[model samples]
Target: MIVLHNVQKKLGMRPVLRHIHMEVKKGECLSIVGPNGAGKTTLLKVCACIHQIDAGSMYWNGQDVYKQLTEYKRNLGWISHHHFLYENFTPVENLRFYSELYGVKNCEETIKRWLKIVDLYVFKDIPVRTFSKGMKQRLSLARALLHEPSILLLDEPFTGLDQDGVQLLFHLLQQEKEKQTAIMMVTHDFSHIEKISNKVIFLHKGEIAAESVQTEEKHIKEMYKTLVDER
Candidate 1:
């Protein structure tokens, strides 16, 4: 399980995450929704350890994440607006690079399997620069899964995807959830959130305006609009 207690963060003296608190259990999904500048991405970045918190505490199971930073990071798989792939490298090459960096055993086999899972195997040998945005997104997903991390921090994971890509992502995430990987995602698409998320949070101006457990997508959107309008 991952837990946050009174988390706070700032970007250049402007508070981005304000006294935030949340928890995600193994095999659970948490979806965060908010209007622009609500710090949804910043929140994910904090969880991913891309940005250090200014205050509060985060824990993995019973261990302090800041104290056990290296071990803590090994359990995280993060995807944001940036794909973080070398455009000049082929899909297979890209996966190989990350696998080696993560010290993954069976690197080749794992890379091949994820490529097939993401429907990128046919184009695995081609450079990422030659791939479409949707294809690059698929490759990015493949890279994130290669290490089988216990936690996923995703931001707008459905961006630039075709129908097939979207469905594939859903299927992959479902598999991850079944394996007890805790997932935290930021997305405007409530339909997918309703399908996969057990918890939903609405944030406004870096604060959680409302939260619900197992809410319907329609209600979630309704709550989101209401919160945004109140701001």
Candidate 2:
């Protein structure tokens, strides 16, 4: 499980996240939603340790993440709007490189499995620069999941995906949830929030304005409009 207590962050002098508190247990999916510049991506980046927090603490399984940053990062997987692939490398080569970097055993088999899972097996030999945006996104997902990290952080993962790609991603997320991987996503895709996430947080102006658990009667969309749109 991952927990954040009164977490705060800033870019230069502008505060991006302020006094945020949240948690995602094993096997749970939490979705962060809000309008543009609501600090949604910043929150995810903070969780991924890409951006340092100015205050508060982050814990992974009861230990302070900063105390064991290297170890803690080993269990984390992140996917962002940028694909982050080596454009000159083929899909197989890219995965192979990441696999080796993560010290994944059976590198060949693992690379092959993820390629098939993301439906990129057919293009595994082609350089990533030759692929379309949707193809690159799929490869990026494969790269993030290659080592099967315990926690997954995604920022606008569904961007540039086609219907088939979206369905594939949904399927992959479901598989991850079933495996007890904690998932946190920042996205504006409201339509599928209820389907994939068990909890939702409405972030506005760097703070959590409202939150909803899956068991709640109010739909996520309704809460978004009430807390985010109204303000």
Candidate 3:
């Protein structure tokens, strides 16, 4: 389980997140939704330990993440706008590198399996620089899931995906959830939120304006509109 206790952050002199509190247990998916400048990505960065928080603390399964930052990162999987891939490396090489970095056993077979799962098996040997945006996104997914981390953090993961790719990602997320991986996603696509998320947070100006456990798509849309318009 991941827990954020009174989490706060600021970019320069402007405060971004304010006293944010949330938790996502094993097997639970939490979705963060808000208009631009709501600090959604910043929150994820805080959780990922990419940004130093100005205040508050975060924990993973009762352990202080910062105290064991290196060990904590081993259990974290992050997929963001940045693919974090080596442009010169082939898809196969990319996964192989990550597998080794994560100390994954049977790396050769694991790399091949993930390449096929993401539909990149045929292009496995091709350099990533030549791949399309959607293709890179697919490869990024494979990279994030290669080590099977306990927690997954995603930022606009479906941005470059087509219908088929979207479905593939949906299937992958479902599989992760079933394995009890804690999932936190930041996205503006309300259409699929209910299908993928069990809990929703409506963030407005860096604070959680509202939250709901009833994740019906229609209800979420309505709530989002009401909250945004009121602020």
Q: Which candidate's lDDT is highest?
A: 3
Q: Candidate 2 — what's its lDDT?
A: 0.90
Q: Lowest-scoring 10 consecutive residues by lDDT in candidate 2? A: 214-223
- Whichever of 1 and 2 has more TM-score, that candidate is 1
RMSD of each: 1.0, 1.5, 0.8
TM-score of every candidate relative to the true structure: 0.97, 0.96, 0.98
CA-lDDT, candidates in order: 0.91, 0.90, 0.93
Residue-wise C-alpha lDDT for candidate 1, range 169-224, written one tens digit per residue: 89989999999999999998899898889899888899888899966888997888
Badly placed stretches (over 4 Å) of model 2 are 215-218
Of 1 and 3, the candidate ahead on TM-score is 3
Write the residue-wise lDDT of candidate 2 on 82-187 in tens digits: 9989999999999988998888999999999999989889998999999999999999999999898999999999989999999999999999999999999988
Best of the two (2, 3) by lDDT: 3
- Residue 144 lDDT, candidate 3, scale 0-100: 97
Deviation (Å) of 167 in candidate 2 = 1.0
Candidate 1 stretches with Cα past 4 Å from truth are: none
Best by TM-score: 3
